[model samples]
Target: MTVKQLSMPDLVDACVQLDIGHVGLWREPVRAYGLEATAKLVRDAGLTVTTLCRGGFLTAIDPAERAGALADNRRAIDEAATLGTDTLVLVSGGLPPGSKDLRGARERIADALAELGPYAERHGVRLAIEPLHPMYAADRCVVSTLTQALDLAERFPAHQVGVTVDTYHLWWDDQAPPQIARAGAAGRIHIFQLADWTTPLPEGVLDGRGQIGDGSIDMREWKGYVEAAGYTGPIEVELFNEGLWARDGREVLAETARRFVRHVIA
Candidate 1:
């Protein structure tokens, strides 16, 4: 069991207390402390770094910017390797400014993935495509469901391409469980992410992460499906809440660890 708070302040405390992990950090956090230092902190704390929070945003209207995105992502892969993380959560960016055609946006993502997949494979890391909730379809990601992510995954080698099923985004989806099961059967379940969904989104359709069992997600049933699909990986919790982030980082970590054990696996 892992609590994915993703706030810089709470990370190490979760590592030491929960003994699983508390955060899935972004590059900014890494940069803040310097990559090597942060990696050392994560290691010294004995936290299991599941997957780096992000690594892909290879969609841009300008050709040069798109190239830059891919180039930047390669560095992200390298950073993940340095951290000894085996997966880099790939968030396929949304459509370019003023674009409404989803197919075109999807093509951009697939193309970027095709270019990066082999590289990730060589580095002994897998790229996990995170399909955002439909609410973010227009601005954050075009692939807004597990089905769509799986479809894109099929285009690459299984060892190189996989999908991330975030509970916050997919819990409401009737088709998510089956697709997740299928992904498990196909050996494409790279990461199992959990985030309870709360009402009154903090970011207005952007923030809905809650502590495990604090919201409406039925983890017992969901975990059952994941196991039935043959996935026996770590369950990572990823949450983004201003209230949590504003608290003492260490306490946040300790509490998350307690709650994860109390509710997630109790």
Candidate 2:
């Protein structure tokens, strides 16, 4: 959500003005704006919904909690289908409360996927399991590497489940390149996203994603990796920086598009 500050209508206008044909949408804004209305808005603008931001967090020890998570993901899948997006990015959840069992937690995610994957397929959507950085391992996500994400996704059919290659999280791992190829070979590279890592991470680290070309990542290099892996899909720039959000959103959207061209496409 690089331009989360923008209202849906304003964001749509910005994308159209910038000639950005495909837009990746997060569930919160779409739900808030009324899902059908948003679907219509983007459809009317002739903009493709690239992928839906999230539909995971399936790690829970309690049965009720686990059931609720699956239900929520089902709703997310329905929303993604309604939005006409084929991909649903998943941030697989972290450890259960007071639980030190990382392996147990991950297995639970697989269990949830076993049920959700087929359901998603029936709804004409695919689940893209996104591994967060290891730093988020304890609380936000346990799938902290592409290898780990692949291990989980491989249990299901490629058309039903895959992995999300997000540079912000995977850029630190040298093993990621090979994993990208592995994912591509199986036709499981569902979506690729770009975000840079800056020094002196912000207070809560979650919103610390740097703007493209403003940090250490070689945007072009990562783009090359995904391309080499045969991922011919929309490349989304998803920044979470509060600094960018504090500024005008339209300006931020325009600036991000320019940065994408200069740093990644040029």
Indicate the worst ten consecutive residues by lDDT in candidate 2.
53-62
* Candidate 2 positional error at 242, Å: 0.8
Give model 1's TM-score versus the native structure: 0.91
How close is every model to the real structure, measured as TM-score? 0.91, 0.99
Candidate lDDT values, in order = 0.80, 0.95
After superposition, which runs of candidate 2 have C-alpha atoms over 4 Å from their true positions?
none
Question: How many pairs of residues collide in each model?
Answer: 1, 0
CA deviation > 4 Å runs, candidate 1 = 1-10, 21-23
Q: Cα-based RMSD of the predictions, in order?
A: 2.5, 0.6
lDDT against true structure, model 1:
0.80
